[model samples]
Target: MSKKVMFLAHEGVGLGHIARTCKIANHLSEKNMCLVVTGSREAAWLLKRSVDFVKLPSLDGLITERARYLGTKLYFDRGDEKAIRFRKTLAEETARHFAPDIIFIDHTFTGKGGEYKDLLLRSGSEIFIVLRPVLGTREESVRHIFGNLGADLIPVLQPKVLVAGDARTSTSSDDVRSFFPTIPIEHVGYLAGPGERTNPSARPYNILCSSGSGFDGEVLSYAMCELAEKQPDISITLIVGPRGSNPPAAPPNVEVILETHSIHQQLERAQLVVCHGGYNSVIEAMSHHLPIVVFLGDGVDPIARDERRIHSRLLSSHYPLLVCEDVKELPQAIHSSRELPAADTYPNALVVNGLANIGNLVATASPAKASDFVVTPIDRTGDG
Candidate 1:
């Protein structure tokens, strides 16, 4: 029956990857065997205690701006070779021992800079790439310089099928086909609970500032806090991720939550959501049909710009969004959205019940043909 499933989630630089990985794991039928391995320090928080979860060394350190610059310096010089090697070895060992029937890699095609590429090739299990609802196509310099060429170096370059955790209407298959043209895709909906009724009258705050991980929104946080301080009458709730916790004083109207497991509760209570434009964040906000303002970043991180920009094009009259480039323009967007009527809530926009859909896709899905598996030597050092 090939019921065993193994999920390899990239190290927790952001909450979206691990969060969506575990969400799918939790929904799988109880009869199936499932194992998840992740590098985020928040691994325990990411998955339920019942699921078999292994925590590995985080690879976030190696995927930063500094690591992208490939000049006279060696690959090891750009990244923490120690951490990268350790994670690769641990992941390989874990997957080898588990001997899964199928493998699900969430977002990171090149795990720890091509760590999983070797593992994916050697493992007998069929592998699938789990993509977020919206896979950003905007290429960064690093993607152009290394992303395309690097895929060729990986042995099992193609996934058996791509499972998208978003509704088909929210994102077109064409968006991702450009990335993996031949691979088939299954839309399993946004990996979250259903949308709640919008009670603008009952909303806890007029402006809700949310993000995936606490890691990335320092400048946004500071600016939001400054905005709140400037405008005390307008209420704001910041659902700070692991990185952006510990905001300034509450100032009566402003509230800061350290981190929450499910953002649905807070999202339903928000009249306007100012978020980091993560796939999960945008989908959740849109599900609630609230006015949205997406934050790209402070220009320090390249990923901020290209990663979230692709979905901005999907914003339509039915789902109007205020794309915030800088904090200076945020207050104006918030004010403008406040005047606009609450957008129509499409509760069924995404497939909320995913276990059956995902199970059917994984169980009956065909493994790639023999030609798909090309022989390639393992890059044990993880430098390549």
Candidate 2:
């Protein structure tokens, strides 16, 4: 039987929310009717032909350049209520009509600004809250998890919590369990983007620098340009996301592409990976067993910014990962990372096959049975 799965992805700063949902939806779409209701215009463009999608009035533009630079506040100025209300109305209406069997709410429990709180209270759909690996402080995580759940919806709406990244490499799992002991939690491995896995072959590019959706990637991208200038012998491919900050110039050895539809193709040819610590980018790099250097920029919000710091610290335990807090340190970090061997011996648990694990859980349709979905070891025989 085909199940109706509705994914609510409220894209705030970057494409992480929608990108994760779309990856799950694309995998589930083969045997299910998947509908992705998101605030991201990029959702429809990224979704497969089988999956249906709808866009709502987005609050993504509310963050100003100063806010992104400061990485502290999120301001919704005057007259933004109209758009907010309209978005709320459209979201509610879509849920009512779709009447999905399963609703996967990305990141937040009640959606942005509690827009989906009413839906959680009224909808008959089985609810699931999908979370990223590294959520901010424990206090903020508690707020996002329980803030909008009033007395009325507390016992009634028992949604299963699913972490999109592996628990072994993620920092939020223990904190989340400590906050809500009884809440059912599942760590469903790294959900890389929708594409065939890159062939485990020798890559031609010496370094591949990428910042997801480049909304706040100015520092990293520009630093890479400077590195390219200093190291004329190194071959670098720089991808400043479509919405990302662009470097003014690049040396002959560095190839600067404005955007790419398939980043995995580029990943196949890279020897070392240097990028901002976005979930997708980090996971994909790990999947390829490449040496990773993450530059934690002040992105979108304080929580998001801190999450990168936590991400770099936690994930480094599992892979040959290095962190750079400032762009000034990036070149040296990259140099240090290059001498390290590929993480071919890195544990195979939770680094790849997230699409399969998540798909199995959805197919079972019973969260209790998720205990059987444990990490199985994989062979890395041919992968160089």
Which candidate has the top score in lDDT? 2
| TM per prediction | 0.77, 0.85
- Candidate 2 residue pairs in clash (backbone atoms < 3 Å): 214-244
**Residue-by-residue lDDT tens digits, candidate 1, 1-384:** 547688988654567778778777776636567889886656576566657788875444444453343112233344465556666777777876676777888766657466666677666667677765554443432243125234563344456444454454344355555555665667765554457757887634567788667666777777778888888777788777766667656566777887887667777667888887876677677667777888777642464455566566455333667777777787787778766655655333445555466777777855433343333433556455
lDDT scores in order: 0.64, 0.73
Candidate topping TM-score: 2
Clashes of each: 5, 1
Instruction: Quickly count the clashes in candidate 2.
Output: 1
lDDT of each residue in 1-384, candidate 2, tens digit only: 677788988675677788888888988999888999887888866889999898875565543453464354444554444445556677877877777778888877776567677766666677788888888788877676566553235457777888888777776677777866777888877875444333434544478898788877887877888888887878788888877755777788888887776677777778778887888788778766677998887644567778888888888877789998877788789888866655755665445567888777778783222222222222334433
lDDT of 1 at 255: 79
